[model samples]
Target: METAYIETPLGIASISGDEDGITSVSVTKESSEKPSTKIPVILQDGALQLQEYFQGNRTDFDLKLNPAGTDFQKKVWDELLNIPFGKTTTYLDMAKRLGDPKCIRAAASANGKNPLWIIVPCHRVIGSDGSLTGYAGGLWRKKWLLDHENPVKQQSLF
Candidate 1:
């Protein structure tokens, strides 16, 4: 029922929720205006958690989420949560996990509609060919998030 904005590496993320639980989180282009009011008491923690996530100081989110969506979309988003940090999965893979071997398109659609953003980790979804694909926040941001989570550490050349 309330919303707050937090500056992040990708952009300014708009977080919305209530005392019951978090309902939505979406990113936007950079903004200069400050929040009209303080982030609601119920949502301040969630906002801070998101800040930590973008800072690479946190990987797993531990707050409650209440994203609004259809039953099928909820199912797909739940499956997306199973994708671990620093990992990726394909849409076809998600479809199979949803117990429908042919629902790849539907699964992809749900993935695209995920409103929880980083909390639900929809950016982890990719094409079956190991290619980075569609992302509502822009593919560049997706690539940035993936790289942040799975930085390629240099190895010794012995």
Candidate 2:
């Protein structure tokens, strides 16, 4: 797979894929790899979408994704995609949607293992009490993304 790194407000983002479509997009505190002088053709659009996302110019991703995971995990990740921008859902809700509320833990596990990061939007999952819960990229980044997607608008004091 061809890999490319790009600087993001969150940090360095590593995007990887080939002609089969984007396989992964992950963020890190730092990366040894430098931003690509020539991003691979397969990854160019995905990278641009991510940049637009961070700039608040894009709400939903529209790139081909090919995240590797088990069938159950794929199901969970697919459900995550249904979550709208600026909206959040709980693990229990995800489990119920998957046709078994008892699978909340499994759903949470799949959510935690989401490989596409912001593209899949596992960060949109929250605790039942509406508290920010687990996020693979760390809670701070999750909070930043949530805030960036749905910033509080200042009210007029007329």
Candidate 3:
């Protein structure tokens, strides 16, 4: 898989994929890995889309994704994609949608294991009490993303 690193408001984002499609998109505080001299053609769309997302110009991703995971995990990840921009859902809700409320933990596990970061929108999942929780990218980053997608608009004081 070809990999490319780009600077984002969050940090250095590593995007990896091939002709098959984008396989992974991850962020790190820092990385010894050098930025791609040239982003591979197959990965350029995903890279551009991610940049657009961070810029707040794109609400939803429209690139081909080919994440690797078990069937159950894939089901969970697919459900995550249904979460709209600026919206959040609880793990229990996700479990119910998956046809078994008892699978909340399993669903949560799959959410944590999601490989495609912002693209899959796993950060959109929150605790039952609406608290931020269990973001593989870090809770701080999750908060940043949720705020980015749903920033509080200043009201006019007439």
Candidate 4:
């Protein structure tokens, strides 16, 4: 595995991957000078795509992903990829789509564990009431991302 750190609007992001594809992306307040492995081309590609996404010039990512997780987590992550850019879904919605209406908590947990971040589109998941909920990168960042994706139409409130 290889790793690299990049600065993002949310925070410093650590990306890791290998020839198989990008494996993980995590956000943190600080950057590590000594990463545990080398920086791979797959991670670099993901970082570049993320930069384009934050600039609002890109909506979809094209890099390959190989996040490490259990079978359920993999299934949840795959479902997350189906969430269109600038759109949102609820935990219950995802759970039901996955054929387990009672697995909302498990769905949320899998969402929280998503390692590919924006590329995986896990931030598109929201509370049942349409409020921002748990986000591994922090709820504030999640709100910012959603707002960035689906900007509200400004109107005069008389």
Candidate 5:
């Protein structure tokens, strides 16, 4: 496995991957001066894609991903990918879609464990009441991402 740290708009992001594909991406408030492993090619591609996304030139990510998690977590992550850009969904809604409305908490927990960050679209999930909830990247960055994707048009004010 290889790892690298990328400085993004939100903060310093740690990227890790191997031949199987990118495994994890975590955003932190502090920078990592040294990584445990050499940077990999897969992570290099992911970093480029993230840069494009922040620039608003990319809506969907194309890099290969292989997030490590439990079976249920993988299912939740897969469902998250279906969430379109510029849109949002609640944990309850996702739980209902999964055919288990009572599993909202589990769904939320799985969403929180998503390792791919924006590429996995975990930021699109929110509270049932439409309020922003817990975000691993911090609520402010979550708000920024959601607002960036769903920009308020000038016509809306008119």
Candidate 6:
């Protein structure tokens, strides 16, 4: 797999992929990354889309994802893509929807392993009581993403 790093508001996002499609989009613990020049041909469009997303011009992504995981993990990740922009869902709801409430832990585990980060929308997942939960990218970044997606517009009083 080929890898390239891009600087984002949250941190450095390491995007990996090839002709088979994107395999991963991860936020590194590092706070900064050098600016990109020419991206790989296969991953170029995905890079552009991500930049647009951060600019608030995109509510959803349109990139081909090829996250590598087990079948169960793939199922969980697929469901995550269904989560709308600016909306949130609980792990219990996801587990119930998958038709196996008992697999809640497994589901959560799969979510934790999601390699496609923002592109896969794993940040939309939360605790059952509407609280932020474990995020591979960190909870602060999760909150920032949610807030970025659904910012509260202040009304002006003239």
lDDT of 3: 0.91
lDDT of 5 at 151: 60
Report the lDDT tens digits of candidate 6 across residue range 1-158. Answer: 77788888988788889998999998887655665676888888888888899999898888878888999999999999999998889999999989999999999999999999898888999999899999987899998998888757547898
Q: State every prediction's TM-score relative to the real structure.
A: 0.91, 0.93, 0.93, 0.88, 0.89, 0.93
| TM-score (C-alpha, index-matched) for candidate 6 | 0.93
Q: What is the C-alpha RMSD of each candidate to the true structure, in Å?
A: 2.6, 2.2, 2.2, 3.2, 3.1, 2.0
Number of clashes recorded per candidate:
0, 0, 0, 0, 0, 0
lDDT (tens digit, per residue) of candidate 1 on 23-94: 998886557745436778889989989888887889889998888899999999999999999999999989
Kindly indicate the candidate among 5 and 6 with the higher TM-score.
6
Give the Å shift of residue 100 in candidate 5. Answer: 0.7
* Candidate that scores best on lDDT: 3
* lDDT (10s digit) by residue, model 5, range 1-158: 88788777777788888888889888865665543344466577888888799889999999889998999999999999999999999999999987899999999999999999899999999898899999988899999999889866436654
Q: Model 1 clash pairs?
A: none
In model 2, state the lDDT of residue 35.
74
Backbone clashes (count) for model 1: 0
Evaluation by lDDT, superior candidate among 5 and 6: 6
- For model 3, how does the per-residue alpha-carbon lDDT over 1-158 read when each residue is reduced to its tens digit? 89899888878899998888889999965767666779888888888998899888999999989999999999999999999999999999999999999999999999999999999999999999999988888899999999899857557899
Compose the digit string of candidate 2's lDDT tens values, residues 22-112.
8888986566757778888888899899999988899999988889999999999999999999888999989999999999999999999
TM accuracy, model 3 = 0.93
Question: Where is model 3 poorest over a 10-residue stretch in terms of lDDT?
Answer: 28-37
Error of 2 at 44 (Å): 0.5
